[model samples]
Target: MSLLNNVFYFQNGIGVLANVFLLLFYIFIILCHRPKPMDLISCQLTFSHTVMLLTGGVVWVTDIFESLHVDNDIKCKTSFYINRVMRGLSICITCLLSMFQAVTISPSTSFLANFKLKLKKNIIYAFFYICSLNLSLYSYLIFYVGGLTNVSETNQMKVTKSCSLLPTNYIIRALNLTVTTSIDIFLVGVMLVTSAYIVLILFRHQRQHKHLHSLSHPRSSPEKKATQTILLLVTFFVVMYWVDFIISSTAVLLWMYNPVIQSVQKFVLNVYPTVTPLVQISSDNRIIKILKNIRSKYHQIL
Candidate 1:
């Protein structure tokens, strides 16, 4: 058990470090470059990943303390709620990225072209709305979740490190699950559909324009490249989302019999945030160019 806990801690530490680097890099990009629609969305996504990873790390560390019999109710609940909000925000941002890319790449004659133009103009407003919606939706956790407690035979008060949802009737539980699941399904569905559409559009365009480029030059256009990147991001998000969902949905049944399910669930939840930053950096040519230039400059100075 100690060895397993150490492994979890090490994984969480690496995720936190990766997210921190992403945060710094995105901030620098925003400050140094003219912020386009894609840039704004990328910045938002990076920020979301940073917060999600940080809160996840806090929760994992708290769990370790919890295993040691340290009691910190408020810290546990706070981190839990914050992590939930950040997780929702991460999903929303990924959906936004996929939707934006789909709209941007639609053909001029397509019906979505007009909406794409308008969306590009008001993407910042859309992003703000998404952030607000996620915060508001997940805010319920603050009121409904708290640390478990136990009373000693000697009449002493004891708080457990684990959090417990407040007692609620079946209706409330069903309603909460419905709402959360609905939103998740809707956003994920949108991401998958739009990403597929973007790929189709890119494929058709490439076939039509194949004669324009030389045989030796097989590189795709910048837009097509970016669309491919967004598709990859959506794919990763979908896999992680479903894996976590399955584990969580069946957790009650499996948790008591198989303790490893909880660990796997936690790992699946954190994997996307840890890897997203690296994916974003690799997909963006500008970011890659800047990083390479920095590396060369450092080497020359050395």
Candidate 2:
């Protein structure tokens, strides 16, 4: 195999394996709890991550096959649409996670804090809204995307086997890329700010002198663990997303013409869905509980 094909095969293999374990691990966590607020949200995130992984895997495999001179038109289109859809859903759900966490941590007397109690029941509905909004926004724009057979040098669009977006009005393309990148930046920024604030608030409340200290009494509060997990999640999101965004944005700026960089950017963006499960598995309570229980029993027998 060519060096690029060999590299992608190994990388995508690792991602697929990691995501499989994550799906199982998160499902275990979901089942262990009595359907708590956070448990439900975590479940949704895991499910979305699985979809992301599957679509990403298909895209990766398709690339490898194309490299080997195998062309499958139906598979290519399916892979393209599925990848885009899952990516949109994943982004929407992550944003929802941030919003939900912010609401959960809001001061008890705040007007929006009332929704905390309703979160377990209402989060799925909120997710649906986010999905719908994404679908609507992407639907029109993706019309501009089609197979290579559809590409032409003429004023309109052309489609063939491989999905190639022909050059459009420079002003319009610039505006679209600018808007898309800006929205991504804004959403990621919101997630970072809210998660950071939650972490700080938790720290402050743990101080005995603060009025909020009583709210964080050790027995009833999962503040420390929850904050730690959310912070890790936000950090992973920022790092993985910026890798993808920066590459994509650079391509858009550099005349949108570099194939090799485009391939690498795609690889980087695809890695996160699989890697994300590892983050979740480490942060999950069920897995930790199982490990601790195993250790405790071992000690007793010893």
Give the top-scoring candidate (TM-score): 1
**What TM-score against the true fold does each predicted structure earn?**
0.84, 0.75
Distance from true location, Cα of 178 in model 2, Å: 3.6
- Overall lDDT per candidate, in order of appearance: 0.74, 0.65
So what's the TM-score on candidate 1? 0.84
Best by lDDT: 1
Worst 10 residues of 2 by lDDT: 152-161
Candidate 1, residues 1-302: lDDT per residue as tens digits? 55655666676777777767766776776798676788788778777777776666555566666687755566666777778888888899899999888888787888988897688888878878987888788887776666665423222212223555555455766677679889999999999899889878877766766867645323456776787888988999999999888777554222221336555666788888878877777777877898899999999999
Task: State residue 76's C-alpha deviation in candidate 1, in Å.
Answer: 2.6
Q: Distance from true position, residue 245, model 1, in Å?
A: 0.6
In Å, residue 256's CA in model 1 sits off its true spot by 5.9
